[model samples]
Target chain A: MPTPLYLATAVAVSAAVTWGLRALPFAVLTPLRSSAVLRYLARQMPTGIMLILALYTLREVRPTAWADVVPTALALAAAIGLHLRTRNAVISVLGATALHVAMSTLWPA
Target chain B: MRGMRARGGARDFAAAAADTASVGLSLFPLGISFGVLVVHAGLTWWWATVFTAVIYAGSLEFLLLGLVASVTPLGQIAVTALLVNLRHVFYALSFPLSRVRPLGRVYATFALTDEAYAMTAGEHARSWSGARILWMQALCQGYWVGGATLGALAGSLIPITLHGLDFALTALFVVLTIDAWRTQRDLPAPLLAAASFALAALLTPGQVLPAAMALFTVSLLIRYALRHRAGSPAPDEHRHPVPAVPAVPAVAAAGGEG
Candidate 1:
């Protein structure tokens, strides 16, 4: 086990770095808020970033494996369908995740 | 005047609470899992609470438990934290922080996790108050901190059969992506996202998150340059005139669900 001082230092270091990243934009962007480039990026970046995040989350899934592929595909479809129908993020995420867990348990492939 | 102020405060609290309910619920299970992992990794329960309270960056905290267990160097830990969270820089580009008061903005920055970002990024975020935004973020953190504390105290006494709970994160992202897509109706962005994902997955399998984000940003800039040269109007040029909110600038900065 590490010493108490060492543990505390590690936590403090981690916190400082994490908080720095979070705070950087607010500090830097205030002045650049009116810049055309930042404005354009603000308009164009969200959908692309969200899409990238969704795909990135599934990056580890191996296409050759049916076990990983099938449930993810089903859950994604369920999420999209539920979201479109109800327009509620909570219901969509919960409903889809439930379906995914159920499939994983039952199939076990 | 005091009575009116009290009434407005109560209304803002209600709005923030209502907004946080779903996101908070989803975070609970993950926080419990994090706490359990901390104990299983030989850390004390309070350590779990401390990490949740201080770090507050959801997935990174999970990774931190492992780093802490191994007695990783502080410099390495800091670098890892930076890489894992570089995406938040992009989030700041659109996050609705300017609406928040200066004091609240400090806390809002600290609380700006992926889930908080996702909750606030939608079209509905246009009308939120600083109070509502800050409270929603605080409630989300409370769910995480409370769940982590509970799980730590319970330790291995809690059943270990909570399989597939992590998918909540993925499901959350999927829902947010759909919402963003519906709002923007921007085809090229999604396509670029797919292209970036493919590139990252193919080239740098282990570091997909940052790799994909960098590629996506590059792709977006290229697309912007091409469209500018072709004399095409920007996507939101005609349909959605910019909102009159002084704080809002060009679709706000890119905050996402962590």
Candidate 2:
């Protein structure tokens, strides 16, 4: 097969898998008519997914970049604060991003 | 929460559809980024657009870009993409969009991006509305389309380096995780994800995120299994009826969808 064909295949397969996984609750719940286990999982799904994603991102940071950590920590704090105070996703994200950019620029290593 | 209105009998499917459209439109930039990346990697813009329109999963899109560039074997790329996106299975499993009309259900499945999933699931907790769910999905797709177009048009116009942008996905995920943990009140979940990610990172360096995600997913499974073995009620036993799914019109959901 041509190389691009390989990528296309990858995209197709990935979409299928994604559909299957994401569709799991629907397929099962529609039949089962409300699964407590599944519901519980759903409740916590965001947290679990986010945690892994966040850690993965942080892990990529060079461990020695203490300066980077400062901005990151600031961003996290800003996000947390904005979320708690305004409970708004857009504002919190923007605020955190702005803070991080400012800090990084001001205190570049 | 000004006009937090609740309608009981007749379902406002049109309203929901409109809402979904707004979400998709807002998210077009995300899709555009993936589109730009795909074309930049030597693929045709049409293919890139088709993929964004079809696949519609952000992280997996980025991963697919890599798999495409390396010219990995078809079978291998397929498996990797499958594994990388395995978490989506869970996303689909518990989404409340299925509660919508069959047509809405079909559309929901097609439009179930991460943002939509988050919004819909949160809304479902309060009241299951086909309109609201549909709106979220549509909006998410909008973002995908917008993002792809922008990326394709201005692939090089934005001189900002792409080096740290990938981290945005990670940061976004982190924020998502934290929010999930805060809302879910389930200790095992956040802990499981963290532990799994840490272990996977140690085991696999470059592929840490995927490996960690897979491991984290397994951790959740194991926790579920252990709970099953013990025959104990899982934490989220009672569905707290959400109060009209407060439309926090502000929280501009961020992160490059791709």
Candidate 3:
């Protein structure tokens, strides 16, 4: 194992950098709170960010070919369908993940 | 503490825990994998808890697993953390930190993980109290830390080795995205996000998130400037959806969201 000092440094640097990024907007925007741009972003950014994040989450699913991408695409369709019908977060997430795992594992590539 | 005389106390903590249960379900498996990976990566079992408890970002922690094992330079590790987490800066824009009190605000900011951001900032949760926000954050960390610790300590015994389990988070965000759409019905915003990502992938494929976010932010700023020029009321404190949280008062509904 690496020394405790080394591990502590790793944790500290990662934590500091991560926390710094999270805190940046809050610090910068605090003074700019009165700015129209800031308010406009508050109205607008959340939805766009959430959409971007959803797409970000899908980054791992790269398309190699048309037919190769069927299962994962089906899983997304399943998730959206379940969510629209039920409006239950738990059901949609679990159902989609279950389909994804089963297809990815059982379906032949 | 004022109007909250009727429905209030530690109940907020419990309610937040319940609020976090769905996401907690996702975190547990991912966290358990992290725990298992930590021990398997030649780190001590306890480091699993240390990473989750301290660094707290999911993808970054996973990246750090490889980095720490390879003895990556500190500067490189810091850069990795910054790049991987740059998306967080955007989260602060709409996060209701202003409504949260001082000490709790600090904790809220510290724990502003993607899951935390989605949970608290979702349309239904706009009126969340400072205490509820804190408790939600604490509970989120608890689920992660707890799962990681369990996985590290008793990993092999758990008998779970599912592939594609990480997709749960993606699925969670998918649901949240749909919910955000249902809430606001903002078609252009989602289209803009897709276009931003598409453009980012076209240009800075390696740094899609930060690049897309920068482009998106600039676009939003342009929209704001145009709207301002068009005389749609300049954004002031009372008019804007204020992000400058007060340093004092208003925990009255601390436990009142029942």
Alpha-carbon local distance difference test for all models: 0.78, 0.60, 0.76
| Model 1: fraction of native contacts | 0.60
Prediction RMSDs, each to the true structure: 3.8, 7.8, 5.1
Considering DockQ, which of the candidate structures 2 and 3 is the better prediction for this target?
3
* Candidate 2 C-alpha error for residue A30, in Å: 4.0
Clashing residue pairs in candidate 3 are B1-B251, B1-B252, B98-B245
Model 1 DockQ reads 0.51
Candidate 3 regions with alpha-carbon error over 4 angstroms: A1-4, A65-68, B1-7, B154-160, B228-258
Q: Model 1 off-target regions past 4 Å?
A: A2-4, A60-62, A106-109, B242-258
Best by DockQ: 3
What ordering of candidates by TM-score runs from best to worst?
1, 3, 2
Q: Highest TM-score: which candidate?
A: 1
lDDT of 2: 0.60
CAPRI rating of model 1 = medium
Comparing 2 and 3 on lDDT, the stronger one: 3
Better of 1 and 3 by DockQ: 3
What C-alpha lDDT, on a 0 to 100 scale, does residue A71 get in candidate 1?
87
How many clashing residue pairs appear in each of the predictions shown?
A: 11, 39, 3
